[model samples]
Every structure is written in C-alpha cells, then in structure tokens.
Target chain A: MTPLISLLFALAGLASLALAMPRHAAQAKLGALWVARAPWLRGCGWAALGFSLLVRLARPDWRTGLIEWIGEAGLAAAIVVVVLMRRPQLLRGLPAVVLLMVPIAALLLR
Target chain B: MKTGFRQSMAWLHAWGGLIFGWLLFAMAATGTASVFKSEISDWMRPEVRMRTDPVDAVAAAIRYLSVAAPASSGWYMDAPDDRLAATIATYDVKDANGADEYRLAALDPVTGRPDAIRDTLGGEFFYRFHFELQLPYPWGRILASAAGMLMLVVLISGIATHRRIFADFFTMRPGKGKRSWLDAHNVLGVLALPFHLMISFTGVLTLITLTLPWAITANYGADTARAFADLDPGYYTRPRAGRPAPLGDLRAMLTDARARFGGDAIGRVTVENPNDAGAVLLVYRNDSNGVGYDGGVAAYDAVTGRLLSAYAEQRPAKSLYNLLYGLHMGRFAPSFSRWLYFLCGLALSATIATGLLLWTIGREKEGGLGNAFVARFTVGATGGLPLAMAGFFLANRILPVTLTGRQDAEVHVFFLVWGLATLFGLLRRPARAWIEIVALTACAWLALPLVSAVTVGLPYDIVGLGFDGVALALGGAFVAAIPPMLRKLRTVPKLRERRT
Candidate 1:
C-alpha cells in the first residue's frame, strides 16, 4: 500500500516536470530539454506531492508515513524550484529522485 | 528598503548557511547515525551479539547488585532490550560528605556478571555529540540553536530566490553549467524541505527554553526552572527522606509496565531518593509508536509498589509535544525507519557537499578562486569532516581495547584526521585535494568491515550482512567517485583542449 502511494507520487512529480516546460524553442534551448518539459512535469510533481501527503495521513505507521512525507516534500520543493527558476529547471528533479529512491530502496531491501 | 531587504536576506542566508552548513551537516548526520546508534553498538560489540537472550545476565547483575549494594539505597537497572547490547545498572549511595554517589556496572550479555564491553564509547557518544558536542553547559546547546536558526534562514531565502517553484518540477539535465548547480540545490532543498523545516523547527523547539527565555521569564516570573517543571510534570523536585526501605523488584515492575504499555520491556530505570521514605522508581518503556526522547515513564511508590503516575496520563499539549519530539528524533520508528533515516541523512550530507562544490565551481568560473575564505572553509569542512568521521570509525575498530587512553586516543585521532584534511585542502588545489580526501575516505570506509571480520569471528554474513553491506555500498560509491574526481583533476587540460 505504501509503495503504491510512493509510486503514484513519483509519477506525479514526473508529470509536474513535464508541465513546467516552456512552449517556445528559444527559451527551451537556453534552459535545456528537461526544462522545456516543465509545464506538464510541474503538474505531475504537485500530484505526487499531494498523493504522498494523502498516503501519510492514511497510513498509521510512523516510519512509512515519515518517509512518504519526506518524499512528497522533496517533490513539492522540486516544483517550487522549477517555478522560481523560470528559465532553466531540469535539475529540480534530483531531490524527488533521491527522496523517492530511499523509501523504495528500503522497501526492496527490507 | 526593498532592495536592501532582499540583498540583506540573500547575504544572510548565503553567509549564515555557508558558515554553519558544515556544523549543521555534522549535527544532522550524527543525529541520523544516532537513530541506529544501538544497532551500530550491537555490531561493534561481538561478545553481546552471541547471546540472543541476555536475561540470565541481567538477572545475575540484579543478584550481584542486591548483594553488593544492599543498603546503598536503590539500584537503577538499564536493562538490555532489542536495540542495545549491554545492560547497565547503577546503585545510588551517599558518601561520607553527604553527596550522592553513583556506582555503575555493565553486565555481560551471556554471563550477566560485571563485564567490560570494549571501551569504544559505542553509539551514545555520537548521539550525545549530536546535540551537546560533549561540551559543558550552554555552549554546545547555544551552538546547535544558532545552527538551527541559520538553517531556518537558508530554507526561507532559498525558497524566495527560487521564484519558479512549480515550473521546473521533475527535470534533471545533469551537466548544464550554473543551471545544473541551481537545479541540484533546488531539487535537494525542495525534496526534503519538510524534513529540513521540521528538523530545524523541532530542533529549535527542543532548545526552546534556551532560545526563548523571555517568554518563560515573563510568564513564570523569572523562575525558568519552574516553567520547565510546569511544562514537564514528570520532573520531581522534592527529595525523599533518607531511610532504609525495601523497594519493589524492578524486573517484576518492568514486566508489569511492559504488559501495561503493550510494548517491549523497559529500557532504563531511574530511582529517585533511594533509601528514602518517598523513593520513586521511574521505569521508561522502550521506544514505541509515540514520539520524543521522553517516553512513557511509570512511577512506582517504593514501599507500596503502587503506580504513582504514568506519562501517558499527561495533558494533550504535553503528549503532542512528546510525539513531535519523537517524530523529529525518529525514536518512534522501527528498525526500517531507522535505516531510512540513516540513508536520508547520508543524502543530506551529500546535498551539502554538492552545494558547496557548486559554490566553489561557480566562483572559480567567474575568474580564478575568489578571496572567499568562508567558502574555502566550507569546502574544507564539508569535504574534510567525512574523512574525519571515517577516521573515528577506523580508530574504534583498530585501537586496542587494553591500551591505556584508547578511548581518548580514538577521539583525538578523529580531530587530528579532520584537522589534517582541512590543512591539506588549504595547501593544495581544491580539485586535487577533493580527489585525495575522497580516495582516503574510500580506503578508510572499506577497511572497517575487514577489521571487524578479522577481530570478531562473527563473519559478515551472519551479522545480517550489515557491516559488509555498509562497507560495500560506501566502497562502491568511492569507486564510482574516481571517474568524477579524475575528470575534475583533468579540467584544465580539457579547457585547453576546448580552446585549441
């Protein structure tokens, strides 16, 4: 159940990154290809963040909830960074990737 | 005013974070390490690992204490549970001068007799150092509070500077000059923003009395201690009248407490006014779902064997505070959560490292290394500290237990290694220095499991593959780092090639 929620959140973050991208090529070139896909990507990111929160609320387990919460926050922060650095935003996804990977890895390892 | 406000804040965030970043990183890393301090202690002590049930040892210690210190007042048993290796019992007695004296004994897990576990200082040292740095009084606490404030400022300014919060969501192009650094910082900051915020806020709150004494002074009328007492009802002020009194059996009390709480057995037992009329035994339940360092403390009347008060009965506000504290400390989490915290902590350290590296790279690109002694210090600190930590772990493994001053020697080695790393950073080229330190770090980390396997006959496989797993993971990371370090070392030639 926790993994499912985390996966959904990760997908959302990916979507948000896609949403955050600019439409035009000139701006896109300067920021890099990932930044260009920001428009949809931002949406996915926000959704992931929201879902992560929901999972935390639903799950009574503190450890899983905490990990999910951290993962969500990371996704949200990535979104915020993307919106702030309007021009080039491809690197904003690192936190989400790292955050999501931790819990997922823990689940696998455990 | 607006420009100045933004500029001042930016400056504050930058300089404050840069100055304290290394310290904060250390605190966080150590705190994270402390989440698994017991497990680490268990791995370090092989003698304790062999005994699955150290109950007999604990019973033996109780018997020993009962005989050795019969009239000495009360014995507080810090029994071994799932987490820790050794069970410690301390007897409270008064000296001829009428001062309290605590005689402590560590019981062997197998024999339950007084045994010396290797003087490695175990996990508690790192745990204590996280908040106090083992310094006297307010200094360590004050430093920690200052770092927390700095972290808060960084979080705020970092958010303000990154205007397009929603636009750049999940994007990572890796090598895009300044864009990459900004992305890296943003990603790390954003992903763990809540963690960063919660940790800092709770950290400040943990030391709230020190940070905001004005509130306590104003409300409680200059009686800060009273204010704390009000906040923490578990604190007892009145001492028991000195009289030899038979106390309730702690082992039985612990069993009752565990049954009541529906949790594991008691971890630590604290007896106040032992041998006094009003002697109270406070048995602390092992870590559970609830939050905070202070768990359910069940107080038993020494003579009556009746429950006086339980922490579970505390008011909502107090309970909420405990929960928040627990959450922040990761005390409530099971073993898995502890592991997760450990990994996240490492990532946080990596985040700081990457950020420092980006700052240096950014400045270097502008036109040679700038006169930012602060940035230089940060690089030295963030990079050098890890090397030092590895040295500490190595010293713990290598230093002979029988050697005089071995404990102090281990601590000194940590400082010496860190100091040397910093000196090397200052003396050598930054890129080259980083490569060298990283290589050293790798060697040190890789050596740990080998040392453990050689000294302790417990093969890496049977210890649930924990030590070897960590070593292999760290070693792989170091091996992967070789390419990057080599690439940075060859930067000048690459630039020349590009120009040609």
Candidate 2:
C-alpha cells in the first residue's frame, strides 16, 4: 500500500517535471495553463519526490527508507520516460491526480 | 589520435557495447531472476510447504543431522524461514579422494523427514549462471569480471559521447527503424543510468579479489588463504578433540541466539564435530535486513551449551566492501524491493538488447557477411535464451518426479533447447527465426500454468501462483508483440541477408 502511494507521489513529481518542459507542455491539452504554472509545477515535482523519499524513510528506519527511496525513484523515472515517449499530453493531468493522491496516501499511512 | 573526444568516445561506446552487450544481457536476465531465487526454489519444489513455526524446524534439522552424520566434520542447517518452506541440512562428508564433499537433504519442516520431491537444480542454476556462466570456477569468474569492467567502460563512454543525453531524455520517435531502436536504447540507458552504473561497478567489486589479486598475492606471497582468513572476520576454525561426546540441545542455543539478536531471524546454524568433545555450535543471525560486514555469529560449546563469543567486531574497510557486495546481491531485500530490483534489471537487459539491435540496424545499409552474422547472432542469442529457460521449466514439469538423474536431465534439456533454437536461427531468415522462436517461447510460457496445474495441481501459495502469473503475462506480451513485428518486417526492404 505504501509502495503504491509512494509510486503515485513519484509519478506526480515526474509528471510535474515533464509538464514543465516546453516540448511536452506544448503537446498538452492545457498547454497555456501548464506554461503559466511551469515554475510551481517544477517545484511541486521536486517536492513530491522529496516527500516520497520521506514517506519511504518513515516506514521503519533510515536504511530501509534509503533502499525504498531508490526503488520508488526508479519506478517514477521509468513512468516519466514511458509517458514522455508514448503520451506527452497525459503529463499535464497526471500531476493533479498525483496531488490528490498524496494527502490520501499520507492519511492512510498515518 | 586526431579523432575528437566525442568521436573517440562514440567509437569506444559502440564497439564496447556491441561486443559485451550479449553477455551483459545474459547476466542481467539471470541476475534479475535470481532476486526471487528462494521463492522460485519453493515454486519449483512444490512439495515442501512453509511452516510458521520455523524455529521448530531448526530444532528438527539438528535432530535429523545428529543421527544422520554425527561423525562428520561439520553440520550446517539453513532454517526454514518465511521465504523457504523446508529446512535444508548440509554436512561435510569425506569423498573417496579424501576431499570434502557436501551432502544436502531437504527435510519437512514439521515432520523433519526428507521431502520426497523431484530433485532439480531449481533457482540455483540461474544464480550460478549469472556470475559463473556454468563454466569452470575461476575462468567463469574472470570472464564475468572482464565483462563487468567492459560494461563499466561502455557506460562511461556512452555518457561521454551522448552530448544531447539530457536533451534526448524526452525525445523518442518510434517506428523509424534504426532511429526507433536507438531511441529505445538511449531512453532505457538514461532512465536507469544509476541502476546500471551501480550494478556494474558493484559487480566488479563483488569479485575484486579475483580481478585484482596482486595486492593480496604481494602481501601474502603464496599463502592467500592465510591473508583471507586474517582479513575476513567471519573466518574461524577450532581443531577437533580426539574423544567422542554426545551433542547438547540446540534449542537452548537457539533461545540464547534469539536473545542476542533481539529476536532477529536466525539464518544458519553450524555444528562442528557434533560427536566430539570439542563440538562447537555457531549461530549466525540473518543480516538480510541490515548493512553489516557479517551477521552476528555466536559461538557455543556444543556439549555444555555455553555461549562463548558473538563475533560482531569487524574492520571498517571489510564492512564497506560487504555493504557494496550486499547491495549488488539484493539478498536482503524484502519482496517489494526485490520486485523493484527485478524490474530495473529487466530494463537494463532491454537497454543492452536494444543497443545490440541498434548496432545491426545501423549497419543494415552496409550489406556484408559480418553484418548478417551480427543480425543472425543477435536474433539467436536474444530470442533463444528465454526460450531455453522456458524449456528448463517445461522439463521440470514434464519429467517424472522419481526419474534417475532427473536433475541432470533438466539441465540438459535447457542446453538442448537453447542449441536447437540457435540452430534454427542460423538456418532460417533472421525475421522468420525471431518470429518462430518468440512464438514458440510464448506457447511454452503459456503452457507453464496449465502444465503445473495438470502435473502437480495449482500451487496453493501466492509465491507459486506468482511464478505462473508472470509466465502467463510474458506469454501474453510475446503474443501481442508478433503482429507489429511481422508488419515491420513486411515493410522493410528484403535484402538477401545471408546467415553466415
């Protein structure tokens, strides 16, 4: 359950980063909206990824946290890369879904 | 000498990656599978059901060994844990040549009797093949190390050459033939760059002594064993007493070890000279969950059941090495992390494979014997191996449980199937060979669940079902892939591509 949530967090983070890019953002449905929110989207991406690491670490201890962080980060990167290749338009909307998931995941985790 | 830095690096990357890509793919594929080795072993041997009372199984194994090989030099019991369903007891037995031969028995966790299951190599084959290549010991180790070094060089060179690597991170144009293959190669390599680098660098470190033994050789002269013993904190030996004596209760020692480790799982228990007055029991905590030089090894006077010393002291240098080695092995990873490792490994394998394909696709315009050979070889090796592994699984299910030399037969089937696939590749057209082999492999994979269901009934546990599930998914993927590939082949210019 934690892994799934953390993966969503990571996906959200990567999606924000992708949407912040001109090429992917230009292809997105809400290109102007993403462009207007580019800076915040980029920040949100990094913050989500960082929060993911924190959530992963919070599980038991630092050692396991570090390992899980690496694993979850890989999954996130893979998801981002695949999205970039196959469907750039999805990046704009993915962040919203990810943002929605984060609080729910945190609540469940708590 | 006049070539530019990027040009030189590109040359190095292309040649190095092409030369070692197949080996890297094989290692990555086998190593990925090896992540769930214990689970796969359990899935292979369906008879041994895991017991909740694993501690009781340790007691059971000790009892079995006491009567079985009391006079042996040592006894080691791999206690039944969450991953493993049976207690495995191995004891040193003197061979006819006066060399020590290890004998293994898989005992039922509850009854403590040997499980009457078909003997097979199980997951150990894949594990050993990853580093050893199923070759003679040092040669295989040396070859794997060399390949690791080449891979490290290739990775470094690849990054140095790809000036637009970051720019191309989001760039992928599929169905452009050579461009498509290159895009896939670049994307996979870039995305999993950290994983590839860590795995390669740590892989070389895992066999550092074999690759660069000069330091030890120079220090220890001809006695490298002495140096190893001095360096490794886990090394310990005590000579046997001439007088015979009955072994003490191991359950008491287990109780002491549990307390020592703060209730951490005990991975192994070793009883040295169990029937001698100098018998010593060594209990090692499973360090799969922690980064350490050695899991805590507690020594006990076997007859008296007295706790002597828990070997926890270690040099920082050795501890660092152990951490690197452990990270690469991923034996300590829980199921979720292990799946993550496996997934990354598959990506790495795909990265190498795409790189291999790109090499041939780039040379498609050249139209030469060498290019043709490379294409054919690529198809044979890449497509044939998975088919071979499927053959191994099929053999395991198909062969009679009690057939003589059944284990050896299963291994033979793997090689035979692989050989036949390679031959088929060599004889047929590259595109045709690939399609046939992949289709055949898919069929075999799809058959795995049904075969198991028919042969031994559906596996009751999740782990067993997981194997079947993965196989079916793989088969589905292959089936889904065929049409697009066939369509691509139809569109490509059909040059007279020779096999040789």
Candidate 3:
C-alpha cells in the first residue's frame, strides 16, 4: 500500500498499455513476438492497474488513499511515456522487471 | 468566427487561453509553491526553532493572552503543526476610537509570546498571490476567478478540439518543433486532465463568493459574515454575561477535542469573550487527515470545561463544497500527492507556455501587432514569474530585519521584480528575453540555497533542506532550458525582430 510500490505497479501497467499499441511497439522495437502478444499484454496491463488501485484502496484511510493512487498513477504513467519517448528500448526491459519486482517488494515491505 | 464547430472551439481555446494564460500561469505556479506553505514559512523563518506540541502551544497562547489581553473580545490561534512550530495569535480588542481591531503576535513556540520574528510574508505571499496577485481588495481575486473560469473553458474546448485522443495518448515527438510543442501541450493537458479540470472548477468556485456575490447578497443582504456563519453547522454565538470568570483549561479542551475528533489533531483554537461568564472555547480539527474538509468543530464552555455543541458540516451541498474546496486548496494532501499537484501545476504552466509559443511560431511572417505582443508577453509571463518569485525569497534574506515596513518591503520587491522582468521582456527582443530572463531565473533560484546557507546557516531540518533541494532542482531545470533557448535565439533575423 506504500505509494512507491503502488507507483511501480502503475508504471508497469502503463508501460504495458503503451507497448501494446502498434505504433509504440514499432517505436520501441518490442519485436513481432511481443506485438503478437498484444491482447495478453493489454490484459496484464489493466490487471496491474486494478491491483495498483486495490493496493491504494487497502489503506485505512482509503478515501485519501484512492486520491493519492490517481495522482501517483498519473505520475507513473508520465514517467513511462517520457521513458518511451527518450529511450524506447528501456521500456522493453523495465516493465518486465517492474512486473516481477513490484509484488515481491510489496510483500517484503509489508 | 469559424466555419466548423471544432474550428470555432479551437479559436476560443487559443485566444482565451493566451489572454488569461498570463495570470493563470502565475496563479498555477504560485499555487504549486504554496502547497508547501508551512514548510516554506519554516524555511523563511529560521528564527523559529522550537517544535512544540499543539496542546502545549495552545496552553502557552492562553497563558500569554490571559496576562496581556485579559478583557480582549476574543483570542484566536492558528495552532501550529510540526512543520511550522510558531503560533500566530490574534486578539480582538476595542481600539481607542471604539472600533474593533486585532493585536497580532508571532508567538514563540516555547514561550507563547511574541518573538522578534522577521517581518516577511513568507509562504503567505505565494498563497495570497495565487488567488489575489497581491492586488488591492477584490480586484485581483475577481480577475483570478475570471481567469480560472476561462481556464476551464479553454480546457474543455481543447478537449473538444483534439482528434484521436487515444492514438496520441503516449505520443511525444520532442525534436519536431511545432509537433513536439503540441505533443507536450496535449500530453501535459490530457495526462493530468482530471487534475486540471478539478483544479479549474474548484479554483474558480473558491473565489466565487468574491466574484459573484449575488446569492450571499440576496440571502443575507449586507451581512455576508452571518451568511457564511450560517453555512457552517457548528457555528455558535453567546453574549458575554456581565460577570467575570476565569477561563477553563484550554489544554484539556484540546485533549477533549482530540478524542472528540477521534484522534484528529486540533488546528485552531478560539476563545470568545475570554474572562466572561459566558466565554466559549472552540477547537477545530485539522483537515489534513482526510480529503474532505469538514473539520469537526466543538464549542466548549470556557468557564466549566463542558462541551456546548459539537458538529461538522454534513449538509450535502456544503459537504460537496468542502470536498471540492479541499481538493483545490490541497490542505489534505500528503507530501507525495502534494508534489504531484505541484508537477501537474507546472505542466499546466508549460501547456500555456507552449500554447502561446504555437501562436507566434507560425505567425512570424504575419507581421501583426497582436502576434508581436503575445510573442513578448509569453516570454515575460512564463519566464519572468519564477525569477520574480526568487527575488521575493532573496529579499526576505537580504532585507534589514528591523527596517520599517519590512513586510511591505518584501512584498514590494516581489511586485517590483515581476514588473521589472516583464518590462525587460517587453523592451528586449522576444528571443533574447527568453534566454536572458530564463538564465536570470536559473541563477536566482540557484542563489536561494546559497543565500539561505550564508544568511541563516541552513538548518538541517527536513523543511529547510527540502526547500533548498527543490530550489536546487528548479535551478537545474532552468539551467537545462537555457541552452535550447540560446540555440533558438540565433535563428531569428535581427532586422525582422526590429520591425516589431
């Protein structure tokens, strides 16, 4: 439920969504194999987003938590977009690492 | 004015956005800075060292007020938090001419008496400038409200005018000139659209009372105070009984109020008719713990320590109003969320800047006075604001602490720098102005930590260090901007610039 962990999930989620798009997929050279897995990637992206929201909502003061989640999501998404623009190849590796790291970090931190 | 609906909306978006963008950019930038109001105030006032508990500070304030203004009409303290420990106590008293006036004191957190505090507006200047632009009376507020309304209009029209919203959601073409600027503007707008829309809506609504007072005027006639008082469900009033009685323990009332608030810390303490039999003590819970701003308030019998009435705003309309107001003011935001608000605010400012740049970028060959004005004005407003804000801080550090009208001197320096920077922008070529002012701003902001380090010796607290860190970060960002500006400045023909 920590903002940092939630932010990583959001970053993973948005990067997934961005990579699913053909234009971005081509820009990032995410590979034909990755592009072919668009639907799965999109689904995982949304699932990560939902989990991020759930993590934020898990706070005792969920009202404040929900608001912070939205703000952090925006911040996270912005970071992904800027990374995609500057170093598209960075997107190829980071999201997968984030996807693996987030849940483990969340559990350990908790 | 345009043939198509989208075109007409775009026309409105471009024109209206630029017109009010000057004030709106300033509003957003200052509002962003004011998010750390307490922290900034702490940075500005290195003199306040004690981090006293709210309960203890309230007790100290009551003790000092009891001895100093025994028969004062009322005593009020904006209870301090951990960030800024000093309490600002105001005592309502009858002046020699029989008119009501306030005795103000910046109570030392430890002693609860006025200290020889430096008379700078501190974060309050930015907070005030956000909505008021430091102008006289209702004028600045009204203008800000109007600009806020226009910002909402521009946001909506821009949304309407945009095509393929999702296709460009992640798009950013940084080196493609106009495409890049447009992409940035659009991304900054759409990424933080919820924030932008909510801020614009709530920002205007916050000042609606001042801008459009029809409802209050019609309902309460001339008694706006009564109208506002009636809006809050916990309001109370009791005439002073013509007998003297010592006030009860304010610290106990605070402890009681804390439990009453279900552990929310007290943010304000007010003692009405202190020393009278019917004296009442009111404690208000801090609004920072929640997004909703219905700060639970309780009125207590100042003589007997009995709870008189306790309530929070629960009326649907008022609750909604408080929620929206709280969102705009960001009083409830924690540090991370507050920084998000600040970044979103800066994005909005950048959107306006890029939008203004779009107008002049394509119209360089149009040879029109309007284009010329926007070209110059954009540089002044966008680049000049941060410079002027830095000057305000520099003045706070540099000014003679005991000089007469020290507060006014700080404020005057703020406005003076803003005006001078704008005038410089207007007089100089737009291209050169952008480079020079931005460079000046970078240096000014970079100078903040250095100035503070030399003057106050830079306290090692989070608030103090955080201010320095942020100032350094901003300075770094502006320093990064100067090379791009200098490179662009070389492209314009000196003769073509002279034609304007």
Candidate 4:
C-alpha cells in the first residue's frame, strides 16, 4: 500500500515537472499528450493514493496516519497545481473544491 | 488582459524587493545560522563538549535533584541529547509566603555535577533573534510577520518579472557584473522556489492568528483560549486545589510515557498546578515523525501518576494541525536533512544578499554615490552586522562564566563592536570599510576554535570536541567572503580607471 501510494506521488511530481517544462514543440507535444490522457490517469493515481492513505490511517499507530496524510496532501497539492498551470481558468472554484474535498476525504478515510 | 497586469506585477516586485531587501537579508542570514544552532552552541561551550554516557549521568542527576529540591513543587530536566552536551534542569520552588520562584542549573553530562562553563546563551540567542529580535512579545512577532509578508511579495513579484524562468534555470556565469549576480540570484531562487515558498508560507501560517485574529474572533466567538484548545488538544489547564499532594517520580513517569509512545524518548515535561493536588504531569515524545510541532502528550495524575489521557488519541482536526506544525519545524528531520536545510537556508541568505546588491547596482547606474548617507548606511549594515555576530560568538568563547554581570557585558560588547564597525565605515571609504570588516570577521571566526581549544584544553578534532566542524564552516564562509570583498574593492579601481 505504501509503495503504491509512493508511486502515485512520484507520478504526480513527474506530471507537474513535465507540465512546467519549456513550451518548445517537443515539450508542448509531450504536455499535450499528458493533458489529453491525464483525466483518467490522474483519477486513478489520486484514487490509489487516497486508498493507501486510508489504509495507513486505519493502523493503530497515529504517526503512520499522519505520515500518510502528508503524502496525500503533497499529491493533492501537486495535482491541483499541475491542473491549474495547464488550464488557468480552473482556479476559479479551487477554494470551494479544497473545502469540500478535504472534509469529505477526512470523513471517508476516518 | 489589456490592463498590463504583468507590467504592474513587475513594478510591484521591484519596489517590494527594494524596500525590504536589507531586512530580508538579515532574517535569512540569521535563519541560516539558526539551522546549525545546536552545533554552534556545542562549539562555543567547550567545557561541556567532553563525551560522556548521559544515561547513567542523567539518572544520577535526577536522583540528586529529587533529594536537593525535594521540597520544591516540580522539577524539569532536559537531559543531554545527541546534539547537546549539558543537561539543564529547572526547579519550581515555593517561597514562605507562597510565591513561586524558578531556578535553573546546567549539569555536566559526564560528572553529573554543576557545569558553570559560560553564561552565554550561545546559539539560542541567534535562533530567538531570527524571529523575535529579542523584542517584547507582539512587537517582535509583528516585525517578523511583516518581513515574512514582504518575502511573499518579493517571491511573487520576482516570478512575474522573470521573462524566461526555465531558459535561465541552470545558468550561472560567475564574476560577470550585475548581470551575473542577477542570474545567480534568479537561478538559486527559482531552483529552491518550492522550499522557499513553503517555508515562508508555513512561517506566516504559524502566526496566522496573531496576524489575522479576526478570523478566530469572528468564527470562534470571544473565547480565544477555547479556540486554541480546540485547535490543539494537547493544551490543558487544571483548576487549583488548595491541598498539597505527594508528587510522583518524574523519571519513572517519563519512562512510562516513553513506553506508551512506542519507545520514543521524552523531549519535554510540563507540570501543571505545581504543589497542589490538581497538579498533572504531561510527558511529550521526542523526535517523533509526523508529530509536527505537536507531540503526543500523556497526562498523569499528580499524586498517583495515573494516566489521564494521551494526545495521540485526540480528534483528527487537532492531530492534523499538530502534524502540519511538526513538518514546518523539521523536528522529524534526521541529521542529513538538517544539513540540507542548513545549506538551503544559506542559499536563501545569499539570494537576499544578491538581490540587494542588484538593487544597489541599478540605482548606481542612475546616480553614482549621490546619496553618500545611503551608501554609508549600506556599508555599515551589511558589513558591520556580520562583525557584530562574530563578536558575540567570540565573547561566548572567551568571557569568564563566573564574572559579575558577565552575560550583560557580553551582550554589550556585541553592540559596542557593531557600533565601532559602523563608525569606522562612516569615517572610511566604503570599499575600504568592506575589506576591513571582512578581514576582522575572518580573523574572529577563524580564531574561535583556537581560543576554545586553548582555554578549555579540548582537542579540536571532530570526535573530541566538534569545535573543528564549526571552525571549518566559519573558515569556509570567510573564504567565500574574499571573492566578493575583492570584487567590491576592484569596483573602486574600475570606476577610477573609467574616469581617467
């Protein structure tokens, strides 16, 4: 579970880096490819990361839960940043999304 | 889109960077020094640097405290850790009229005896000054928060102004003039943007309530105490009971608390309602990962030492806050990560310095030293501050610990040295001032280890005293100072040549 969560986090980081790369022809093509396929890939990646975080949270040790939350938050923040950079207009409802997702995620995981 | 928003942002960035550049530079430099605070403290206090097994020594000290200060309400002991050598103990004593008094003593880890090495506060002074500047409560915090806000503005503006962030991401052409400095500053700032952003944001967030109290006042009603309690479950207050009770053994309670927290050592112990029946003991875990600034606190009944509650079992909101607080403090970071943080902190300081230099250069092109006062101020502040800091460390190493009013004298010497440096700068040429100040700083910093070794007879080796690491670090900083100092020196000659 930890490994899967780590992999998702790594993917999120890579995605952001790829998005942030220079807007040259090749880089733009790569970014566009990711943008085209990102919806499904990001959804799966977030889901896996969320699940692993939940698994870690359910453990008796509170430290493990806290560690998992950090991982989840980092992945979530990375995804939001990448998405916003790709499509700046997505920032309009970001605050509301954060407010909703954070409580909902906490409830579901807890 | 037609409003020239980018241009406005660039303007804001330039002005903001120019306005708070010096303060930000001081904060960054002090903050960088603070990252290695414990190590620096160890280097300064040579008497306590001797290696001794602390377990037995601490146990013996605890036994001694239990006897000597038995009538005292509560005793708190900070046992020697991996980074620190002296074990500090504080005792809360009740006077005849029922007034409370606190006494503190530092004990050698080896002999379990009082070690009155030096009265110098050591690196703690720099660490505190970085944020608080030793000013009274809210004022110091306000100043720090203002600096933090300026940093945020500078960062945002800097990013907006940079035409090509990635194109020059890895480009650094040293010794090229203002353009090179700008490139170096941009590269360092951009490469470590995430770290800088996170650190600054978290720093502001740490004091958000102070900065924006309306958020809590409006949301949580008038009970600020309750609001803070809700945010932090570890916080507890006990109603005083007039009757006194026999307090339990703190060492034993600490052992039990450590076991409960999954074998983590006790970092700090807090006793509430000391000398009363209602007194409760709270033991916190040390160096626990993910605990953030918040730690697991196990409350025990004062008399019987029965467990009341553990913070680890608190609500999710409170625990989450703790975790965030912990992450920002880097309490969980190992030795390697601490070094990384130190290096990043130094880079941040360099970034601020270079940013300030760029501003000065920009202004210089328009008017060459027209504002002599401003130039003198810059020379005094930039060069004199380092000399003052070096003097502080030197005083800590050389001053007699038992001298009457030595602590105050040491601090006075710091200010005096800094004052003299500034006066010298105003009287002399700015270029000459820079060279002289750098040379003095280099000499003072390089001589610190030798002073410590000679005075305390501690070997300068890494294994023996850990003083050499500090000496070498300080020496390296001095070495780095030479190129920049010489560059400033050469600037004067270049200007003269151009005029000729």
Best-fitting candidate, measured by lDDT? 3
TM-score winner, 1 or 2: 2
TM-score (chain B) of candidate 1: 0.86
Please identify which of the two predictions, 1 or 4, would achieve the higher DockQ against the true structure. Answer: 1
- TM-score of each model's chain B: 0.86, 0.92, 0.91, 0.86
The digit string of per-residue lDDT tens for model 3 on A37-98 reads 99999998999888888988888878777878878888887887888888988988877899
* Per-residue lDDT of model 3, residues B136-198, tens digit only: 878888888899999999999999989868889988987676788889888888888888898
Report RMSD for candidate 4: 10.2
RMSD of 3: 3.0
Off by over 4 Å in 2: A36-40, A57-60, A108-110, B50-52, B66-72, B92-101, B493-500
What lDDT score is found at residue A43 in candidate 2?
Answer: 95
Q: Write the per-residue lDDT of candidate 1 for residues B195-269, one digit (tens) a residue.
A: 777777877878877877887778999777788777866544356576667666656665666776765656666
**Ten residues in a row with the worst lDDT in model 2 chain B?**
B491-500
Residue B109's C-alpha lDDT in candidate 4? Answer: 67
Segments in model 4 whose C-alpha atoms lie over 4 Å from true places? A1-110, B1-3, B49-77, B89-105, B109-115, B291-294, B313-316, B368-371, B460-467, B487-494, B497-500
Across residues B1-500, which tens digit of lDDT does each residue of candidate 2 receive?
A: 32999999988998998887778888888888898887877887888865756578888877877777766899888877778887777788777998887766677787777747667777877888899988898999899999999999999999998888866776677767777888778878887788889899999998998889899988999998798776754545578998998878878888888788788888888888888988888888876767543657788888889877777647778788878888898877877888888888888888988888888888877999998888888887878888888888889889998888787788899888878877778788887788898899899999999998999898778987899888999899889879878987776654435422
lDDT of each: 0.65, 0.81, 0.85, 0.65
Q: Give the CAPRI class of candidate 3.
A: medium
